[model samples]
Target: MSPSVSVTCTSLSFAWPDGVPVLTGLDVAFGPGRTGLVGVNGTGKSTLLRLIAGELAPGDGVVRVTGQVGYLPQNVTLDTALRVDQALGIAAQRAALHAIEAGDASEGHFETVGDDWDVEERALATLGELGLGHVGLDRTVGEVSGGESVLLRLAALLLRRPDVLLLDEPTNNLDLYARRRLYAAVTAWPGVLVVVSHDRELLELVDRIADLRSGGITWYGGGFSAYQEALAVEQDAAERMVRVAGADLRRQQRELADAQVKLARRKRYGQKMWENKREPKIVMGARKRAAQESSGKHRILHEEKLAEARERLDEAVEAVRDDDEIRVELPYTAVPPGRGVLTLRDLELAHGARLTGGLDLRGPERVALIGRNGAGKTTLLRTVAGQLAPVSGEATAHVPLRFLPQRLDVLDDELSVVENVARFAPGATGNRIRARLARFLFRGARADRKAGTLSGGERFRAALAALMLAEPAPQLLLLDEPTNNLDMASVRRLTTALESYEGALVVAGHDLPFLRSIGITRWLLMSEGELTETTWEAVADPA
Candidate 1:
């Protein structure tokens, strides 16, 4: 147990420009060791990180931190021209200068600060520790693979050795080996670690899990496994509470109905007695008084019970909001292969002249092209889509094919959802196009909203709708890293839709759970200028 660094927050709230509130009132404390931020995609995990990083100010409440913090963003784009050593050297020099300016310079500064020589050597040593010793120190960031760049960023951050390390999906693009290496380094880190990731493997290394939902934080001691178990228990409790609330509401309604019936009968009897005039005045007055007393008492009791029932219902509904998992159902419109969809024999793809080896793809087969980042997965997708010519080998696809690239590049940022759909499906009218977009969850005025204003998830959904509207409708679909930004529900829905599709599917993604859920039968693992069919044992069994 190391001495912990503490971060305390009280009554924090944040809202975007669209008046969408992210955090309502969040209060939590972060101490030393690794702490994972876990939740669904839209649950403000990234926003909270930005807030802690001082990149964005909280609209309300206080965020207090003890020491320096190092933040590694999920998107690690870097300058391509600078060598790995140069990239880290700059950061070190900046830190050194800042230290000197702050009057913290010591005899150690003399050994580290001269002529950019000391820091560059130290950078190489740090890179070696991160399992990048083979990487030439002179190699530019852009010349390396995406996974390598991610490692480079990690190396740079590690050199800083701040009090707290904030990592956002650090292993998203890394291969299994790189991912394991990252985990090892995280475990070895001496700082207060707060990692925002959906990877279960990464979460297992954490000391605690923090779930950010509905503008609040729920802390679970222990690791990801413990958090998951606690969430299951909470979900079960929520279900029971929902059932009890519904029952109470129904009982209240029944009592109210019975009271109304009694009142009606009493009125009718009093009217009959008056009309018949067969009873004495005293008896009639006594009957009227009894009726009044009964009616008053019943009305008061009904009101009280109804109020109680309504309060219970509200509480139950609130609990449901916190407990209900996201549910997304993708449209199930599958097109069958008429003759053959695609044919590839001895095909080759590469980055520049570097050969990515030979491969074969036949029609009517769902193919999963998988590998670490920069393994030419996207390049292969482009080749299959006829957007890129293969460096060598024969390739042919007769049927119509639709391609959804890793990024939603097909979307027209200037146009609204309706316009994007209408442009893709020119035969359709505004109403028809809007109706089509609505099926993908863009409804009413939202269909008229500009695509540029939409979130990353919304953009992906809109793009899917557009692709589905192609004339001669595609019999084959190719997706590249489609699940990167999708919420868990969206991922599930997309999987379900693809599962039921009749067309041949070729997907390139690193999401293990998603791949298993969609039922990938075979995999094409891309590596250093080679593609091979590996055993599917790498996939974990679904829980």
Candidate 2:
């Protein structure tokens, strides 16, 4: 199959049943080589990919796909009935059949029989590229970690040699090493690629950047680093324009006011002179007409000036404000820690029938729960949160804690922002509830907006608000992949907030910069429920 593909969308639009248009009149084109799709959390980046993959049809407009395409969604539930090797073999067979159907028989294939040897060679090469060459042929798919399963899918896609590869948030749960390896492999890939990811490092490796926002795609003809620089420049220009425009509007308003005041004063003086009856009739009449004309002209000019000022102000406001993201302020309250906040002795987790291992964590110290996908980091968190009991061991926590799971499932999606906040802060009045919500950027009518309507970032902000609004703040905060769908700006803001937090934090995050920025002092790596003490290194300058 040809390595290059072209995709184009014209006047495309789509919306849910309630008529909330996710994409509107969007037009975008993708060519060969790697491309990064970027946008805020709820701007429909993933929706666009689905549209391209033909998983969802556009409500309006046309999407033209010029070649065979393979897509990997942000998340998938792999069939567990098949063994790892069985799944891989099934994928390979499919790829071979697909290639034969496409009439590509260069690498393997008899004159006409059996699985194409050429296709088999290509499939094995692709698997090797994904670091899955040693995957035992008999291993079950259900036995592999999430990351391993995803890598398997990726390998399958490559083997298929589709003209285009669409990957949506492919590294959401991948560790630093795994993510880096994936990046390297993708950068070296020889086909058209469109990836939706918030990993700036991965974006840096792409050939072009496409930013989807407000139902449109703005194509930046450079890599992620260049895109960042360009965005900075754009923001600076917009800010300057806003300042200049505001000044001009103020000056115009002042000038118009002064002109009107002078005209009114002149008219008053003329009237007084006429009232004395010393002036001739002609003089009085002329003076009155002159005053009337001047007043009319002044009123017209004032209106014109006001209108001009409003136009300039609106332009400046749009330029300055529309590009910026809403900032969130997470509240921090001091909490007294118990004698021992967390204590665990000889705890273990199992994968399949084997006793994977044991963990012993005892301390007043801040612990970091770390592990690869399927290594039981989340499982360990659940156990610590008391949501799940340990298989066999003693685990204890003395203080009232707050556990923010990987998914913000505790939030009431059906409630409004104010309602959600009020649920936890029953003593707070409506005004106070709104005030607290505003701190998280749910100001004005947004406080009344349903939580279900909120984007991922907004949902996270709401979650943060509810936690902080509680009278007795949580002394322990357990976060799992807290930065999952958050943009870089929000991530930085949250990191700053967490830095000042007085409570003990047990966070599991795969974002390298984020983890480092928040200052992870200790590392407790979890593997199959077994915790191991690993040296935490600065990924930025890991010499």
Candidate 3:
């Protein structure tokens, strides 16, 4: 964080072309410090970052910044033909320097060189810092791994020396080693750094957390853990207020009832007196008028009290967040304890990565596939799912299997969520599928939404539902980076859904916290064309 850089949004607003509002009149300021911008999916975290980065225009209001800004979007796309120096934005400078060294210096070359005579050195240093030391300046972008391409983009940003840097889910496709390198960069950032991510480890490196929700930002000092603690305290107090307000509402209702009964009794007594002619006509008329006025006043007073009580109750309820959890039974996916799940015999994948020897998985074991970017975890999973033929050896599944790829392409974009689930479970009736989808948090109209219209979180839930609720009830499940790009709440919902799965599961991901939460039974390391058994402690501290 630097004191010279600042970012502020004044009366900011934006909406999609479909007229669905995302952010409206959002006013927030980011001072000199690393800020982790977080919220559930569809809360406009990425949209706000885009607004700040000038990638998207604000429909209303203004965005102000005091210095140059660089943004690393969630999806990093670089032309395969681009050279490393070109990707880092230093190719022109390097060429000018080389021309000068060759005694061919022109005024144009001098102008391009300017005062940054050590641009190449700085570029190499930044690349090395991001664990791209082996990547040569002249190498093509396609020569590097996907994770390396992400780091290359970040290096380009760092070379610009911008005062404000924005990153949206920077760790989405990165492996554990690459993520560590990214974490180092974030820790050492000197200017204003705003990152939108669900990576708990990355969030923990921030100076503060700005939670975007309900079209506004709630600032919390410290990292993600502190933010969670503060939020817990706030929610506890809100629940207490709700209880108190409910009690007051009930009390007001009872008092209103009692007042009405008393007024009725008085009216009855007056009527009886009038019938018996117990008082003079003039006095009786005066008494009747006074009784009517008192009754009206009393009735109005009680109604006002009841209204105030109801309003207070509504406010109290609003303070409590309604984050629903997925609660579905997946008994059909259950595998027998003694069942043979999968087997591999000296498996060699199409990509030239091979297992050292044979491997066997039994029962309802949950395996965590840990590897670097190009280690063939996905290829192995695909082979197990029978999507690919192994170049050598064999891979076999003893039970029904399903693979949820990283891209989540199992869904049909043209169909509604209910229709998609129905496609997977063709044997189930429409009513049965809808009832099961309700457990995935898609109830009523939500189930009717076209899959193409779903947000990232919603799409993940829909895809998961379609798979988990399939007719054959896959007894063996393989997931490749299932948590990538998912917000924390959606990740939790995924975990909840898996809790009831009762099947043999194999997940390939770098999210250690999530893997631990889902109770991974075994850890397998894929490195250098070999698979070896490992432990949680070993993976966490790979010294």
- lDDT per residue for candidate 3 within 216-295, as digits (tens), equals 89999999899999999999999999999999999999999999999999999999999999999999999999999999
**What TM-score number comes out for model 2?**
0.85
Candidate-wise lDDT, in order: 0.76, 0.75, 0.94
Which residues of candidate 3, in runs, are more than 4 Å off? none
After TM-score superposition, what is the CA distance of residue 426 in candidate 3 from its true location, in Å? 2.5
Q: Candidate 3: global Cα-lDDT? A: 0.94
Expressed as tens digits, the lDDT of each residue in 1-543 for candidate 1 is: 347576777888899988988888888888888899876667788888888988889999999988888888989998999877676656556466557768986767645666654565667787777778888766788787788888888888887668888998887778656776798899898878899986767788899998777667788988877887887787778778878988998899899989999899989989899889889988998989989898999989997998898898788777754322222332333444344667666776646423334444444567787776777788878988889998887667767788999778898899898888877678777776766566577779988889998877678878877877655566778998887766544665566556545667888976665676677767877777567787567534211
Range of the 10 consecutive residues with the lowest summed lDDT in candidate 2: 352-361
Kindly state the number of residue pairs that clash in model 1: 0
lDDT of 3 at 382: 94
Which regions of candidate 2 fall more than 4 Å away from where they truly are?
Answer: 1-5, 82-116, 136-140, 273-287, 321-332, 335-340, 349-367, 426-431, 538-543
Query: What are the per-model numbers of colliding residue pairs?
Result: 0, 9, 0
Query: Order of all candidates by TM-score, from best down to worst?
Result: 3, 2, 1
